[model samples]
Target: MTGKLRCAVVGTGHLGRWHADKYAALPDCELVGVVDVDQEAGRAVADKHNVPLYDDHLAIIGEVDAVSIAAPTSLHYRIARDFLSAGVHVLVEKPITTTLAEADELIELAARHGARLQVGHLERFNAALMDLDLQNQPPRFIECHRLAPFKPRATDVSVVLDLMIHDIDIILSLVDETPERIDAKGVPVLTGDTDIANARLQFPGGCVANVTASRVSMKMERKMRLFLPNGYVSVDFQNRVLTRHQPGEREMFPGIPEIVSEESVFEDGDALMAEIRDFVACIREGRRPLVDGQAGRRALATAIQISEQLSA
Candidate 1:
């Protein structure tokens, strides 16, 4: 509500560094500080960005208007809970919390404190997905594949939460409905937890989404295909490309599968920056975030359901 939105980046590790950098670059945002459990990591990022660094995240909570929590998934509930309780708006990474109860608490806390709680479902901001017209063409069937080479960093959780949850968030947003049933299965390969997983979600509208996520893949691929009555859409998350194929338009080609394709290409842009900027703007304008706590909870709940089914 003042000259600039002073924001802090908590947990200055891999993703946190990107958050700090984006806040530093935004003219409307003031990078008040960076915090991490690892003091060296925090100080190094702050030094690079020329901002104050804190070893304890709470030290900067009162110093900034908002925060981006990029800490470990386990710490999300505590950190986000404390920040929101203190009336500091938060932009938390995906899988808002490890459990549905924790996610619910944060949602209520944000509302009670009158603070914004934004979830980092970054794919919603992807240019390709942004352009697709989801008017009356909600998919009856959705297929998603999110595969990546083993990275020791995010293996704390299963591939369902780490990777598949992204697609789950997108699908939930697109379907605009609640799931009626879910059946899932997975096996742990590289890690003690599930390294590859798949889920079939059944919604009330007869919509089904078949989602698969793997962290033990040979190469990386993030793609989704939506099948509708009149046309189909394919999105490549890695390349930010969208291809659409629709039915024939001309009378001469009536009843024929006349193919029309347009590749929606977006310039290689910084998604992290876009996410942070949107958070800062929300803080300044007091507007609800595009990915609010309820939105996050929807995705997290679906993921938990799938993970439970896998365990069974």
Candidate 2:
């Protein structure tokens, strides 16, 4: 809380290694250590960053002021709970935990210890999404598609949790309302869990979102389209492009109104760094994070509901 905040990255796998690198490069943070169940993997990252390596998170929990948890979804609750109970701030990856009850417990534990709990809803930091001018324009209809080729790394959870949850969080944030009902369907292709799924969410205010995610696709695509009362907006997450369509003053024909289209493209931005910086800033400033425990809980709750419908 004084000079520079000490931080550690737990579960130094594919994503956790980058978390360690970012913390090491940040000026306001000190990369204290890295933890991983795989000792070789952890040691490799630590050596590259010149930080200490630990086999277990418990060994480094007392050494850091904050921790980034990129562990497996099943271990999220236990790992995050231990750190938060120790009064250390946490920035855990998305879907906070496997169950709603676990998420609720983590939120309560963070508050009890006065520790900040942030969720890694990475897309919320997307440059294209961040640039959208959707302040007053509430979307009436939202459509999302996140497709990717099969990868064996995250097969422990269904595609809904692994991929669709990103769009779910974004839709939930934009609507700011709990969904009244959910209809979902899914099929398992390459894993025991659902590899491709679709969900329809209806909010109280008549806003609806149709989300689809597939891990067995041939190509990768990450896109979302929002239909607002005054216009339509499209965001391409992979390419960092935003396109807007609205009515123009001029008429195209006798009775038809002209439509104006504008497109904005952005460079591949560093969303993870921004997310980590925000977490550190919140901890230092005593402010709430953009994606806090409650928001994470909401997204998880909705995702669970969809998953249940899929199973039924």
Candidate 3:
């Protein structure tokens, strides 16, 4: 915990390369190695960071204190299990794994081995949400939309797992209870799987969420609106802006309260770097992460419900 912690990044793809960059730049971590079955991709990242490169994750199991598993969703469970079994802390990418059973097994492995298991829900570290506190003020209704143009890189899963799950995770974090009812609809466009989908979730405590995600959209947007008891909150993820509207003392008309509005534009920052920094800090301090394996499993459970409903 005192000396620089040794760290490595597995699957040096697009996002994995970024993880390597952060570990190389962090003073508290020494970039131990980068791994990828694709020799060209892994070597590129490793040479760029001046670190060792490996084709398999097992080679660095005993050498690293922590690792970032940015491999494909299908391989998440296997890679994470191996690392956790070796007592190496892990930061696995979103959707946790292909199934809830896999997620549960990984979580149990981390506990059994006494290692930290964090999920890469990168949006949780966004600056736009830094001031928003949903703990004390739960919203009665929530609306979310995440849209992006078609990209072949992430077509391995449906839009529900690829995009919608981010918002699903955020909403689940806001409300501790799982949804009591789920209604969903989706269709296949470019990919054999559903490229666009929408789900309506009703929680046990009367909270409701309507979420829509599309990978075939013409434009990109990431936004969420919350209707609280005393105020309205809006988060523009693309622009990093948080806007709130609350009732004021001065009335605009008889029996009507004036609405005071405030908007905050956050500075452009790197959310991935913040996520990595937190992972390292949690490993050093021996504490639970913001998005632990349990949270990831919760998100995956809800997403699976929506996906199954859509297909049925």
Candidate 4:
């Protein structure tokens, strides 16, 4: 806890490579090694960062203080459990595990071992969202749409888990309440699982969130709008833009209230680095992560509920 923490990145694919890069760049941590089943891909990232590469995580598990698990969804639970059992802090990508039971087990394991478990809800670190003033005013109504052209990489899971879960995690964080009711519908398009899906969640305090996600869109779009008591806010996640609208004193027409709008753009912020830095800081300071295992579990549970409803 005094000197630099030794960290490793498991699974050096498209996203995992970035994790390795960030760790290498941070002065507070040392990039110990990289793990990937694909030797060529793993070696490429390891060589780029000047780190060692390993095919299996267990070989280097005890050598590192912490690890970033970017493996496939199915392997998340097992890999995370192994590291947590070894008393190593972990930062795993979203949808903590394939099932709620697995997520619960990991959470318990992390707690029993006194190791930090941070979920990679990357959007929680989005610069646009971080710039917004979302403190006192909770959103009463929320709408989210995440669309992307078909990609075979993440087709192993449904759109609900792959895409909608991001919005779900954000919404759950804002609402701070479990959904009382969930209604959903979806269909499989390109993959065996649901390619496009929609879900309406009703929270305990009359807050409602309507979410839609698709991997079969012509254009990519990631946006979320929130209707608060005093004003409205819209965020373009892809562009890192935030726009807010509130009632003005004067009206354009008699007896009508005019609207005032303001916009903020963040073009040069690195959310991934911020997220990883926070994980490292939490480990050093003994603080909880912004998005912990329980939060990820809640989002995954809700997503699974919606997926079940879609099937039913």
Cα lDDT of model 2 by residue, 1-312, tens digit: 678899999898888999998999998899998988799998899999898888888998778999999999999999999999999999999879999899999999999999999999999999999999985988999999999999988788999999999999999999999999999999999999999999999999999899999999999999999999988999999999999999899999988779999999989688999899999999999999999999999999999998998888
Of candidates 2 and 1, the better by lDDT: 2
Write the candidate numbers in order of decreasing lDDT: 2, 4, 3, 1
- Which runs in model 1 stand beyond 4 Å of their true positions? 250-254
Could you tell me the lDDT of residue 158 within candidate 1? 88
Per-prediction TM-score to the true structure, in the order listed: 0.96, 0.98, 0.98, 0.98
Q: lDDT of candidate 1 vs native?
A: 0.88
- Clash count, predicted structure 1: 0
Q: Highest lDDT: give the candidate number.
A: 2
Evaluate model 1: give its TM-score.
0.96
Per-residue lDDT tens digits for candidate 1, residues 1-312, read: 878888898888889898888888888788888887788888899899888878788788778888999999999999999999999999999989999999999999999999999999998888788778855987989999999999999778988889999999999999988889988989999888999988888999988999999999999899999998778899988899999878667543656666777788887756677777787777778898889999999999889888888887
* Tens-digit lDDT string for candidate 3 (1-312): 799999999999989999999998999899999999999999999899888899989999889999999999999999999999999999999989999889999999999999999999988888887678654887899999999999988789999999999999999998888999999999999989999999999999999999999999999999999999889999988888999999999999999999999999987767899899899999989999999999999999999999999888
Question: What are the lDDT scores of the predictions, listed in order?
Answer: 0.88, 0.94, 0.93, 0.93
lDDT of 4 by residue, 111-161 (tens): 999999999999999999998887599889999999999988867789999
